[model samples]
Target: MAKYGVHQLRGIIGDFSRVTHFPNANLTVVHNQSKRLNQSQDLSHIAVALLVSTLMQERFVWMTAKTNGTTYRSKIVRSMEEAFAYIDDYRKTFDTVEEP
Candidate 1:
């Protein structure tokens, strides 16, 4: 079931919140590491492409861009202060949560 549920493209698309007011919420950070991320190195560079796609979702993502091997950084951040200051015009939504 987990495999059936966690499709990347659909997951990213479905998490958008359209009706809620902007939040002054804190963002969560995501950091990733792998072993084969060097240019023309013995290891493959697959995750690098994935990280690039993920980062393009927003800005100021606070990434520690790698100097070698397959490592990636990310965060699920929310700052109404910064959002309103910068990202207000570019509206976005997040994945849905059921009301309690």
Candidate 2:
């Protein structure tokens, strides 16, 4: 599920960049990171695509994964702080050069 969330976030960033006529290399970096994550996890493309479609219409996303009888959950909420935090972390995660 983390893989799918990153995938959706990348797509949204890319589409926004194109629609606004503002090209951003950081967006591409993030997309590449997500692609790598997906490949590393060996996720199902079809399942991820369907999940991305479902997430497009929703303000909140919740994902869960279970291993060794333990379950983990991650939630993304549509709030100003959450959005900013995600962007900040993404920027740091990929170590992209910031634009002035």
Candidate 3:
């Protein structure tokens, strides 16, 4: 039920990539809309580095980054729906906890 604030990256690619964070959900999503096959290692490195620095409990990168062979701890997904499903599942983990 948490709303997400999106941070879009411009001029980096045709479709560009969007980073959205849902603080209340403890989720961070990177939606890579670019179709470009060749993404530089540096860019992937920087993206992963940023994700690693975040305190969010869950991180997801959708689209092209998976094909680029960049190693990251964030879950690589194929679509926004899948990402949302993952977040939903994650939230269920907390639902089992009883309130103090």
Candidate 4:
């Protein structure tokens, strides 16, 4: 049995969502949020190239952490920041407008 690390979880999520449409699963991380049953699966345009693995145990650590590349990581970070900005704008417009 192959044990997958936390970093690979995003791809796993995307893969799983392609086949199964579970209602309770939070597939947002992979941009596979369940939508209208009659429509086709929605693919989020978000760029998800970086894999930030979750920490499981101290004993099982990667001997040599393999990276796709620093440039890719930077791109991921930039895209994430862009997403945050969009979220902030949406919240300001719809969520916080009525706050006194």
Superposition TM-score, candidate 2 onto the true structure: 0.25
- Per-residue alpha-carbon lDDT of model 3 for 1-100, expressed as tens digits? 0142112211121111244444423222232322232242223212222222232312433223454454342244445554455445544543444245
RMSD of each: 15.1, 14.2, 15.8, 15.8
Candidate 3 lowest-lDDT run of ten: 7-16
Residues 1-100, candidate 4: write the lDDT tens digits. Answer: 0375332222211112122232323333222322331134222222223222233211111111112211211222124445455434444554355477
lDDT of 1 by residue, 10-97 (tens): 2121121232322323221122222222332332211122212233433323232232322332223344343343222222222222
TM-score of each: 0.17, 0.25, 0.27, 0.24
Model 1: ten consecutive residues of lowest lDDT: 44-53
Candidate 1: which stretches are off by over 4 Å?
5-11, 15-17, 26-100
lDDT of 1 at 46: 19
CA lDDT, every model vs. true structure: 0.27, 0.34, 0.33, 0.27
Q: Which scores greater on lDDT, model 1 or model 3? A: 3
Give the better candidate number (2 or 4) by TM-score. Answer: 2
Better of 2 and 4 by lDDT: 2
Ranking by TM-score: 3, 2, 4, 1
lDDT preference between candidates 1 and 2, better one:
2
lDDT leader: 2
How should the candidates be ordered by lDDT, best one leading?
2, 3, 4, 1
